[model samples]
Target: MLEILFEDDYYVAVNKPNGLLVHRTRIAEEKKEFALQILRDQLGYHLFTVHRLDRGTSGVLLFAKSSKVATLTVKAFEERQMEKLYYAIVRGYTPPEGTIDNPVKPDKDHKHKAPQDAITHYKQLGTVELAIPVGRYQTARYSLVQVVPETGRMHQIRKHFAHLRHYIVGDKRHGDWRHNKMFFDELQSPFLLLHAAMLGFEHPVTKQYMEVHAPVPQNMARLCTQFGWKDVLPAAVFPPASEAL
Candidate 1:
């Protein structure tokens, strides 16, 4: 069953687990289950997706209860009125904070297509060094980063981190194979380290500001603990509005 993070008359959100598709797709024809179907069955009502989360990402996912609400939310995203934050464990230490302003190709199938503008801002929350050797080094290093994407593009975060040569741990398509194997063998973790930690937007019907957060999943939390980063991973990625004020 999916975990409901927020729900109301016109909208609903869930903490979508990694490895679950939001809905059926031609590429994943063999899949028998999806988040959309599961949530709809659980709630006994139809739902419309407002956005998407990669199959390897786990966290806040929103759905609209009606066509009108879905249309409004979709427009908000297209206009960049919604704020999305993600947490990723990347190989090697990242800068204290930085912005990746690079253009990315729209799809791998169309590699020759014109690249679209992609901008992601990130802040390093913590760093760790492990004794496991990887590549030419006798020890491994990693960083936990909070990412805020200003523009959405296909696999923007994964591609941008790879462009920086700080590949995300367990990112098979755009990560260091040696490092990925190290995590699987040493930590028994074979899942992508990127997570959609929070989403902030306005209520389409009420026009009230809102923010919803999904706590770090256990797998990532365990990895953080192994790296002595337990202190840095916050219980809630985004504080309540009252606490922020």
Candidate 2:
């Protein structure tokens, strides 16, 4: 079942799971399930998607209850009135804080695609070093970072991080295959580490400020615990004791 993080008369948000598509696409034509369809079925009503999350990324995804509401919310995003927060585990120990103002191609399908302006600000929340060795490195190192993208370009965070040479741990397309192999074989984590942790926007109906939060996946949470970085995660990421394992 999709975890509903926030809902109102005008909109609803869900904690979309990794590997789930926001909707059917030619790239993933063989896929059978989608977040939009599942949520529509779960609520027994129609939904209007305001944005999208990559199939390999998970976290707060919003939908409008109706067409009118969808229009309003979409405008907010275009105007940069919405705030998006993400959590990512990337290769190597990142600096305390940094910004990536690199440009990225809108899509990889086009050979001479025009690059769009993309900026990502990140703060390092934690770091860990493992004795495990891979490739030329004697040991492995990684950092937990909170990311806030100033622009909503497709694959912005992934591409920006790659430009910085700090690839996200499980990003198959733009990551270090060596580190990905190490994470899968040694850490038992084969899922993308990028997660949409939270979203902030004005209520389309109420015109009031609001924020929605999504808990990190259990695998991601487990890694934080092992790295002693659980304290850095927001309290909203944890469910009640009854819901926890």
The number of the candidate with the highest lDDT is 2
Q: Write the per-residue lDDT of candidate 1 for residues 1-245, one digit (tens) a residue.
A: 88899998998999988899999988998999999999999999999998998899999999999999999999999999999999999999999999999998766677879999999999999998999899899999999999999987889999999999999999999899999999999988889999998899989789899998897677887777666666666668532221222
What tens digits encode model 2's per-residue C-alpha lDDT throughout 121-189? 999999999999989889999999999999998888999999889999999998999999998999899
Please, what is the TM-score per model? Answer: 0.94, 0.96
Candidate 1 residue-wise lDDT at 184: 94
C-alpha lDDT of all candidate models, in order: 0.89, 0.90
Candidate 2 ranges with C-alpha deviation above 4 Å = 239-245
> Which pairs of residues collide in model 1?
none
